[model samples]
Target: MLPDALPSRWYPIFSSAQLRRAPTVVERLGERLVLWRDAAGRAHAALDRCPHRGVSFKTATVNQAGELVCPYHGFTFSPKGPCAHAPVLGRDAKPPAMSLDIRNVTEAHGLIWAFTGAVEADTPPPPWFEGLGDDLRRCADIAEEWPVHHVQLTQSMLDIYHVGVLHRRTAPGSGQVITDFTMTTTEDEVHTEGRLGHEGAKGMPFVARLRLPGLVHLDVGFGLHVLVGVTPIDAKRSWVWARYEARLTPLPQLDGVIAWLGAKYDFTVLQHMEDLPLLKSIEPAVPEPGVDRLIAPDAGAAAYLRLYRRALSGRMEVAQ
Candidate 1:
């Protein structure tokens, strides 16, 4: 099971494209949430259950005023969760003291992020790879639900040593031995840089960075960058959002094409064909310290685990 008090951070839950005019239902952080957009296209999130009758907001509709109208009893709620209307009473009648549990939400980098902290004012803007710019306009976005705990999925990304063996079929020549692996950690981030080595093969350098909770950025050289965010849906499942950016050429048009092709090949072929099978076989779903042996090459994953435990214990204070 995941820690009850997860690090208070913004967690990506769904692709922005997936949430449209209707109220979309999503499960994250072990809670059911309803997401919708206002007329201005800004997103909002609230608990999925209506406070009045406990009806699920999944069957609700968004009125012209952007209020969520419950399908069961026509109880209406505004974007901020206050009861806006109650059809059982007169149209203009005052609503009772009823409201949904509102959650802080925002759209960024082609994904919908929910702040998992208590005080919204204390939360910082969603974290992104400054190297990827303010948006993912030039990248190809893809999302999938992996049937493993989010911690497992995240650690896999930090474990670069698996590339050569796990991805050998899809990414040929990636199975080189690791060398000069170095990892640095701060209060809420982990940064790693290393080189790949193999006899008779030229050395290739790589870089990976992780922002607390579940965000990873990997630079594989040749103008290719990979960003991954793992959000926990429940103890046994997680949502993985990935963006692939390829800037092999000077022209923006060509770069866009390459990004799209690379996203398909890397995410669909390499990930689905290789990583998925092995990841699903991991035991205990969620990893605990001392459960597995660590070697020199597992430095990155080790750092993440250490930070995760600190966050869970409420000792890792995030700067306000």
Candidate 2:
């Protein structure tokens, strides 16, 4: 979870393919936002509420002049969000003092991002997925809306313990026992080093990295890397997006088909199906240490909470 007092941060609202000249509604960090692009293909983000009647402008449309026209009253607004026209008022008439509350928006790396917070504060650029660089070939992407809180969704990805049990059929760990857990935490990242199975029998060492606010990179070896990001839609809902990338597949031509099918079975059908029923069963949204008896395997979750607290205290300096 993010702290209220922290400065604005860029959060992904839509994939590049999802937004166009039409207004699209997206909820993030507990606020409803409207996203659209202009005739020049410039992107914009604003509060979905129309100032006049407090109705959502999500159903609004863009006019020939490239302004957002409210569906209820035909009040038009510029991309910067000041009122440009009103149906009842004449063309020469001056618009009222009301204006849409627009926020900072940017498009990059095949995603649309919005900066939400105080207007005067300078927001840092969105975090880059280092695993998306030239070294890896991004083969497939998928997103799922989970009923549980974003924190729970994040923890499930970091726990190596669930692999053997929850993913037995889909992931098939070959009866491997996971142990020898170690975790290191910094203000920005949590690094975990562990063994997959019991000592000497093909138990490959595993390394996982989690960046602040829930961006993950799992190095499963064999040129396979898994990237996961969780964006809070509200206190109870979240949008989880993941990308499967590989570098050295024996058959490059079939990589796309293989990645898509693997993600469908292992991620959606196996892992998430197993996690949903269990995570939703937890009583409180944010559970305390004593709520459940946690063992060594839960160190990753513990580290995540510690880092979250440091950030909440406003003591952690975010690198721009």
Candidate 3:
């Protein structure tokens, strides 16, 4: 989420590598940014504006000194965003750090998260963090994008409505499926949690919950964790980035299989392919203020959407 202040920033932006193999310019909430990796290999996000004269630095070419330089006046700035030295001015004068607005940044789970708010150096990455990176050599879980508003896509993960219709063969259904669940919410968050008592041999329908206006963390089977990271691209579009990893399952000897099976069971790709059309066709409907149009089974759906709208109101910058 984001801090509702002029100086505050949010992690509602792109994950690492998603941008590219190199630096890129990303826009969110109407603000442009220069996202680049420093010489130390640390990822950094800056205001994208050169301190002197306000030229867009993301478009500025990188100079031999490893600093971003504006072609118009030859003013160079470091990765930290301070003017390294103004060739037109003098190398003797140093730019004040105060003049540069540096964002709190961290790269994890393949995302380069930055907060415009007063973020601490230790603010954890999105809750989806699970040893994910570009190497692709790590344990099976891979990150990919689903073309849909992140919040909507994520909510689908916990939406029991589809668990039976879309994935009738999986948990919460296993046996023709029943229609009973609960969706509750709070001021800052909403959760849809329920269980599918002895449906088949699948041992109870494991248990699931969706916390919105963002973040969907679900448990498919015996501690197998499926995390979906959502980032809004705009009002009607966004990214459904998810990580299918295994954790907390009581099957250690089958850990590898559990992870692989977990990923497979999630059928992440197959599920999204089917969901693409529906999500793409649906309108961008932001829940109205003080409305409770929920039915008996509409528990979690309503709660999740409400919390999500609150998240958006806080200025969660959409991850590009």
Q: Rank the candidates by lDDT, best first.
A: 1, 2, 3
How many collisions between residues are there in candidate 3?
Answer: 20
How high is each candidate's TM-score?
0.93, 0.87, 0.67
lDDT of 1 by residue, 230-288 (tens): 99988878989888887677776677778888989887788888888888899976567
| lDDT at position 282, candidate 3 | 52
Candidate 1 lDDT score at position 170: 76
Candidate 2, residue 144: how far the Cα is off, in Å: 2.3
Candidate 1, poorest ten consecutive residues by summed lDDT: 1-10
Query: Which lDDT values do the candidates have, in the order given?
Result: 0.82, 0.73, 0.55
lDDT of 3 by residue, 1-320 (tens): 22221123244466665554245776543356777665556776777676777777656666555566676677767766577776755767765652445666777656666554566667444444333323332224445445555555655666654555655544443443433455556664555555543454333443455533355666655645566656554555554555555555355445556566656655554465566777766555443644545565565666666555555455645532
Candidate of highest TM-score: 1
How does residue 162 of candidate 3 score in lDDT? 59
Model 2: ten consecutive residues of lowest lDDT? 1-10
Arrange candidates by TM-score, highest first: which order?
Answer: 1, 2, 3
Candidate 2: tens digits of C-alpha lDDT, residues 132-225: 6222234667776778787777777788757767777767763456666788887778888777874466576787878877778887766666
Backbone collisions counted per model:
1, 0, 20
Candidate 2 Cα RMSD (Å): 3.6
Model 1 scores what on Cα lDDT? 0.82
Total clashes for model 2: 0
